[model samples]
Target: MNDTYKMMIVDDEFEIREGLNSFYWERFQFQVVGLAANGKQALDLMQRSDVDIVLTDIKMPIMDGIELSRAISVHYPHVKIVILSGYKEFSYARDALQAGVSEYLLKPVDLKHLGESMMKLKHLLDTERQSSQKLQSYENQLANSLPAARDHFFQSLLEDLLPEYHEAKEKMSLLEIEMNATYYCCAAVKIQWRDQPDGSLTDANKLAKATTIIERHLEASQCHSYTLKRKAGELAIFLNLNATTVSPRKSLSLLFDHIIVAIEGELGGRSIIGLGEVYQSLLSFPDSYKQARSIMERHIFRERSGLFQWDPADSLHMERKEYPYSVETKLLDAVLEGNSGNSTMYFQHFWDSCGLDSEHAELPLVLRYLTPLFTMLERRLDLHGASFETMANLHMPFTEYVEQFQTLSQLKIALDRLISDITLHIRKLNDVVQTTSHSAVQQVKKYIEEHSSEKITLNQMADLVYLNPSYFSIQFKKETGINFIDYLKYCRMEKAKELLRRIDLKVYEIGELVGYQDRKYFATTFKSYTKLTPLEYRQSFITY
Candidate 1:
């Protein structure tokens, strides 16, 4: 809050030092904080006081003004210096300037010139202070936003959205993420609380305690690791392991064993962890994450809480099957007709058609079959001008909703209740005409326009408006007369064309700026859209 600068005067003559110090320095917005008989004393004063400006003579007993200026430049660079010399030699001025003096004033110092130089230094100091404050503020904001940014980046990485390895690495560097190893693996942890009586620890408290334990153990492991708290009581950890690590699997197992014991023993909870296979490259991280998540979801069927490591030989091998679209259609038709009996029958038939048996069905595999049905039902509800939430009360994603049930019977009961609710809503809205809102479509279009230079996907847009991806695709085409993918392409190409007019940017640089990381692919797509290559288009602009 103090706008007055602190000034220190250093000289061998007691009269000169007192004479200058006695002057009304306060009128110049400065306070005479120190009067040093020599440069050495001035440097000592600087170490104790916050001296802003120093006025010193070139010749002193212990240390000269030039020596003092050099010392301040090294130790306190922010402090400004003004050299006052009786010798008007160019060499004296040159030495003072080379030592980082702000200004040099001759002896019999002119009061007006001194005042002017002091004010000028004050203005310069104010500017530097303001710049430093702004830089500090920016740094604070960056620190506050870093966690969310890191989460988003890691989410994208786990989803395999950042396909370019080099780009991903660059982002990691910018975000200050370090993974200093040649191999990586992923693990998922889920904590299930035991029944607690009144006044017991809350679930959030339990989770926090468990997270502290996990993080402490992770830090002790001395391997590069990051923990993502995906949701309540759930964590995903990515570990970077050195190639020289002796049996990474054994090391991880021991580490997680300690974590599991600490959480259960201290928090009165059970923990389940699933470890994925290690890979040599970060590009395979998504594969590892998927494997970890799949194995973790199988904990619902397990009899005990422990670490489950992915074994390539013992992994469940299920042949991939096409979605039963015909059965789903029948179920959707039954719901639309408000035929409760047929809807129930068709829902059961749909389940049967997915080739899932209650005894041997894995949770992930079961959800995979159920996801398409849920999407179909959501689309049907959207078309009928009905809110999906009103029908099913599913406030979360279908996959998460399905994970709550521990048994096949419980899951079946939940699905049946959902179907009943859907049929009931259908009967209630029998007289309502089928309609779709253009608001969600318009929002997606606006987002595409604004973020054409970023990676955009139909699923991301659909998630933005809480719609099924398939339904969103159909609605987008119905509203815009172009499919979602083509619309995205159109937006990117339009941006690319606009960037082509800028002569300063190279072709590859422009391509990267417009969300195309691969120059060849950008060129091919640009030619396909505009009937000319990017360089050719730019040359045409120059020619015109």
Candidate 2:
């Protein structure tokens, strides 16, 4: 792919132009984008398209090869030019060569020699393009970010602790971050140093160097990004999906790989990156950020290295923490079944079974059981509209109330209230998910209708609603009474049936318009759904 270069052939003689074009350009890793009869035509085409190399005859009616070569040399200097001359005039050859033409071929150009020159020119172009892209990437990164401002804003953004979203927007504007991206995700690199307590000066110097290398690598990443030094002592890069409007998640892995490869090869820094989930809204970025941080915290505790992506499992790392699972499971089953009558009874039983006996209760140990358990139950409840920041805020109240409870009775009361508060939040979120998920599913149905001409996938629609793809797949089926893929195919078939109503559209054309590139596959799908081939379906409709 890198070896491929675009070229143009220009000459007054059709034979010469046709002859050059006849020789397989693709064989030499070249593509002929244009063929011009005169120098003026060639120059015009060169100006319009990216013609990397131009092969032209020395004599032409409109503009002589010498004049065209000189004009190209002055204006489109990056373009390589090869002069072809039937005239034995050494002066014409010398003049063309002086105009910075790459090569001077005789009247009957040798394909062998031309191929060799093209191979060399192709290598040069590839090298130059890579260098230019790197330089541009570095310049763009430098121009967009400042240490203090970027850090403060992103730290506040990802921690999801910003006081006001409007303030965040203002800060982002001030930082020149375009808020036009469809989705965003955070990548956090947690630096874990060796046991050796190096000198402060030495550590600082290496840190600065590592950061510089990181920024250099980040610049090469083909996505809009912002960097920050997090309070957790990690370098955070917020990635904005720019190339496509589909989803950041689709390209995230590739970009993450780019970051990992660059740092490993260049920085030699001891770090593991935590890849956060994709977020749609600005407020949600903090939750995603927290997710990244939480994953990084796992890296610290597990004493593991490399890139670890955020998963719900990270929050449940205390697998060995003993708790009354039977009672907990009974409580969960009651809640999920919406047996509100038995739910509280089951929850109380679980609390009692924890061996806390109120008086001997260690608050910290109690929370370790409660925290992940609450999250586990909440997942089953399908909670939404709550950020991790809000959950973290629970820590202060939880700790304060624990201090206020001096007796077993007081501790039990506090525990009941806490449980009640958590359950209430869960129920409220469940109600919201029930109502909103229906509307969101409908919204996806409508979106599929609108984007019938383009590719539509379950993951793309899941990203649209910010739901886990598997969960959304299930919910979509439960709500609409059709599996997502089947629903999409049905939608496409419906659109195809409508398109078939048009006398101007052929069956194959209708297939393409309805997001099916393979006509045979479309026909099979259409027949499977509607019990008729596309033509038969159209004819049946025409009978109406």
Candidate 3:
């Protein structure tokens, strides 16, 4: 007997009811809950027991089958019903059909046809139940692993999995997603509301509606495809170029030009576009993305409505310059020593040393010169374990902040302000360092062990305990037998070994849990620490 169906028989005739219960029991494989003489008894039994299907005679004493069908249709639409009748009563058949009856069987019901109908209904019911369960399971999984899914998608893009046009289309469909076309680009859009409008326009739903409207109009009018995601109160578009199948080069170039006009025109010149270069492979997208953002950032002093393209052929081209590592080394030393005076002096020298002799004079050149400086200064602050709170407290944004600065001169002023704030911070940091204590050294060690998985530096650890790095290092070796950096690495390797025993987690997840930020580097370190690869280590511990 198939476990898929439970049947209930409702009939007033004793002979017909008895015959159906006995003859069809073994052949049709349906388990009868109990036989009822009328609709009232059938409904009562159904409420008390589990029934998947019901067979009811049309004419009964207490209540009729039509009334029962209507009640079941409303209360349990999921439970299927087959009406049993004698005579060719068209009215009864129509009433049953209207009430969502599964089938109508004649009173000397054909056992063979009844068996076939039950089998078909059973298969359909099982299929629909499984489909619903599968959907619920998928939604649960998605809710639990949203972060991992985001990482996987980004990693796929970075790994060049989407190379050909067809491959990209197929991949998106499998994920229940769609994108525009190949040759992707990204632009950050910042929307500032005037006085927050009214309640109607300020809610999340309203913003979502606006986004939908924009996407629909863009796609319908221009035949472009795009995915929009919100991050940090800014809207970012992962856009694909759109064009009919034609000359590859011409199609791509023309599509990009149209994208630039369509996107800017829709925003009514309220946004700046950072046009990334076209790439044959998705893996190269990040590189192109960097260019687009840099291009947009570097030309901030120009007209706000101005459109810039990363492709060299579209506009003025500038070659990327590499700053000397020696300059970085010198700046790092001054910052570490907490000598704000020397740090300021070295930064000025670093600026003078930048040999950027460009002809397209104005915002571009200024941005170029400051880009490297901003990076170096940011690194220094990061090395010191500075938080966003610290930056705000200092009344300065990091020198690399590109959001508000419009001109090269404005950037210079921002940087100058940052330098002043950094100098004050340095003096405060240096004072704490010079007066380091043994307890402070112990505190640093404890902090390192606790946060081994996170990115950490010597200066940052020292800052936590309010100690000078130079003096702190001396005391740390005195207390722990090894240098601060060595101790931190040792702690990380120990944690990795413990994690290696847990076979459920992937190697990458384990590596992320450790102090190592670079996966390759973590793998190498794990192998060095325990003469086995992470996978091999996990395999050894598997007993069953």
User: Ten consecutive residues with minimal summed lDDT in candidate 1?
Assistant: 162-171
Score residue 378 of candidate 2 by CA lDDT: 46
Question: Which is superior by lDDT, 1 or 3?
Answer: 1
Per-residue CA lDDT of model 3 for 1-544, tens digit only, reads 2444688988898987887788555445567878998998988887778788888888899899989998787656678898878857788788899998998878676778878877787777777778867755764564456445544665565443432222233334223233434455554443323233344444355445445654665555443444344443234445555444674345534544554454445432234445566544433455555666677666755544444666655545543433333464556456555567776777666655664333334555555556545554555555455532476453334333654666545655565566657667765765664445677876777787787666567667767886545546545766788766667768888888887775445687677666443465577667766889988888898663
TM-score rank order: 1, 3, 2
Q: Write the per-residue lDDT of candidate 1 for residues 305-369, one digit (tens) a residue.
A: 79998766655463344345556766876676577998999889888877674657888789878
- Candidate 3 residue runs with Cα over 4 Å from true position: 1-152, 155-173, 180-183, 190-210, 222-233, 245-269, 299-303, 313-544
Clash pairs (backbone) in predicted model 2:
none
Clashing residue pairs in all predictions, respectively, total 0, 0, 3
Q: Per-residue alpha-carbon lDDT of model 2 for 5-68, expressed as tens digits?
A: 7899998888778888888778667889999999889877876788788988888898988999
Error of 1 at 29 (Å): 4.2
Root-mean-square deviation (CA) per prediction: 17.6, 19.6, 21.3
**Cα distance off (Å), candidate 3, residue 78:** 8.9
lDDT top scorer: 1
- TM-scores for every candidate against the unseen true structure: 0.56, 0.31, 0.32
Off by over 4 Å in 2: 1-147, 163-167, 193-201, 231-233, 243-247, 301-304, 313-544
